[model samples]
Target: MNLVLTVLEITAPVFLLAAVGFTWVKLGFEYRVEFVTRLAMTLSVPCLIFVALMRTDIEPSALTTLTLAAITAYGVLTVLCFALVKLAKLDIRTFLAPLIMGNTGNLGLPVALFAFGDQGLGYAVVVFAIMGIYSFTFGIWIVSGGGSPTKAIKEPLVGATLLGALFLWQGWETPTFLTNAIELIGQMAIPMMLITLGVAVARLSPANLGRAVWLSVLRVGLCVAAATVVGLWFALPSVALAVLIVQVSTPVAVTSYLIAEKYGADSQDVAGLVVVSTLLSIVTIPLTLAFLV
Candidate 1:
């Protein structure tokens, strides 16, 4: 009973903020998704990642373990999702990337912060960074049939992750005033991302929701299983293990839809994934958290 309430308390603000964006769009308001996304990705999210890594109190060894665990989990997920897509006779280009990558940034970060505190947020950031690099590189290639690996290196998120990792390793701190300013900007990232997630979902036009429902269920199951195996294999600490499961099991990201739309890989199918998977998370996240917490 206590655990149920704790899970709700952690997840409520995330969905509520997203709901605000969803409602705002339904009421016929203009929200430019591309602009908001650019702002968050280029500025706010980078700031958030950098500061979180720099200030994190988690041991450096723990961070490295989590990083390797995340990489292995995603690697396993890629192979598994590929096999599933082939077996289902789905369009591999359209379904593969979305299935493999979860919404680690907009959804995962905030949930980690609320559920596990600052240290958890720190661990979540590492997984998110790993996903960002993979999504920009391999995810793009899968969606577009060909993508430039160089583009991943050019992403602000990648730069931030590398820089942040360096700072963490060196035990360096930015000047007080600078850190405060960066922290303020970083603080905007969570709410902005949550609201943007709602706005994006509101605007998406889903198709084949029946298929999407089952696929989403499979996605959550496979992701949780893979993350659990990898976490145990790495012997991750309790908090890190919980964060790994939650982050990897997050719903399909809105970016998957955007990529499909841009690359002409059946945008409606991807949109179905984004909508169905996110709706499904309202149940799955709390249930998983109930166990983890």
Candidate 2:
């Protein structure tokens, strides 16, 4: 009834933007995913993160608590997913990172924004930042068997997170003109990410979909459970807890497939998980929001 419409109002625009990308690709339009992703990550996304963190009125202590909670939730997921991978006899390198690192950025941010507005976006950014740090460091190490920790430090998003956090801690604000400019750039991030997600999905060639289906189901279940436990244990406010649950439980990121391809670890299988899990998210995310809202 009213609840269903509310959820739809929140979710419809996200999938529709994605559908535009999917349909564009299907119609044989030219879309350079690599270039778009690089632009978003390096410029737009960093701007978004920096601006959001700088302007957020959320208490520093609350953010610190959520940070610890996100870390604990990921730790718990890592342990659980490792056991699950071992039991399923899947390639640990390929399956583990994707399972542990959900699509918190491309999918999670926008959903949070739609469902809970600016404050939700701010909270979601914290979770996304934590996920980004881990994915760049530990997630890469797992996939490639070797990676430099310094590389993660060099990432623009990481740098932005650090800078933004410092600004928040100091209660500093950028000049009005600069803040508005950065915000304009930041505003581009969500739509670009959503459309890029669709383009990536339209292009992925998933394999062994049956295996991917079950694995995706497991991933969703495990992420929601871990996030729930950690959020409640930390007593995160209602919106923060709900944001954490949704972000952690998002579908497998397309980057996992790209990393697998780069590192030579059954990219097709990872692609399968990405596609299946993302498609599965269309249903799972809204349902989760139905309750959270």
Candidate 3:
């Protein structure tokens, strides 16, 4: 009973913010997704990642372990998703990336923050960074049929991750005033991302709802299994382990639908995955948290 309330406390703000965006869009209000996304990715999100990584009090060794574990977990998920797509006779290009990469940023970070506080946010950032790098590089290549690794390197998120990791390693701190400014900007990222998610979903028109439902179920099951195996293999600490499970098991990201639309890989199908998986998270996240907490 107590755990149920705890999970509610953690997830309510996230969905509520997203609901605001959804309702705003349904009511025929204007919200420019491209501009908001660009702002978050280029500025706010990078700031958030940098600040979280820079100020994290977790041991360096623990961070490294979690990083390797996250990489391995994603690697396993990619292979598994590919096999599933092939066997299911699905369009590999359309289904593969979304299945492999979860919504670790917009959804995962905030959940981690609310559920486990700052340290969980710190651990969540590491997983999100790894996933972001993979999504920009390999995920793009899969969607577009070809992409450059340099594109990932050019992303501000990647740069922020590298810089933040360096700062963490060296035990360095930015000047107080500068740190405060950066933190303020970083603080905007969570709500903006959540709201953007709702806006994006509101605008999307998902197709093949029946198929999407089952596929989304498969994605959740496979991701949770892979993350659990990898976390146990790495002997991750309790908090890091919980973060791993939650982040990896998050719903399909709305970005996947955007990528599919841009690359002409059946955007409607991808949109279905995003909508179904995200809706599924309202139930799955709470249940998973009930166990983890």
Local distance difference test values of all predictions, in order? 0.94, 0.93, 0.93
Expressed as tens digits, the lDDT of each residue in 1-293 for candidate 3 is 77778989998999999999999999999999999999999999999999999999999899999999999999999888998999999998899999988999999999999999999999999999888888888988999978788988899988998899899999999999999999999999999999999999899999999999999999899999999999999999999999999999999988888889889899999999999999999999998999898
**Worst ten-residue run, lDDT, model 1?**
144-153
Predicted candidate 2 versus true structure: per-residue lDDT over 45-80, tens digit per residue:
999999988999888888899999999999999999
- At residue 184, candidate 1 shows an lDDT of 99
Which residue pairs does candidate 1 place in steric collision?
none
Q: What TM-score fits each model?
A: 0.99, 0.99, 0.99
- Name the best candidate (by lDDT): 1
Question: What lDDT score goes with residue 56 in model 1?
Answer: 94
Candidate 3 lDDT at 222 equals 95
> For residues 1-293, could you state the per-residue lDDT of candidate 1 as single tens digits?
88878999999999999999999999999999889999999999999999999999988999999999999999999999999999999999999999998999999999999999999999999999899888988999999978888888898988988898899999999999999999999999999999999999999999999999999999999999999999999999999999999999999988888889899999999999999999999999999999998
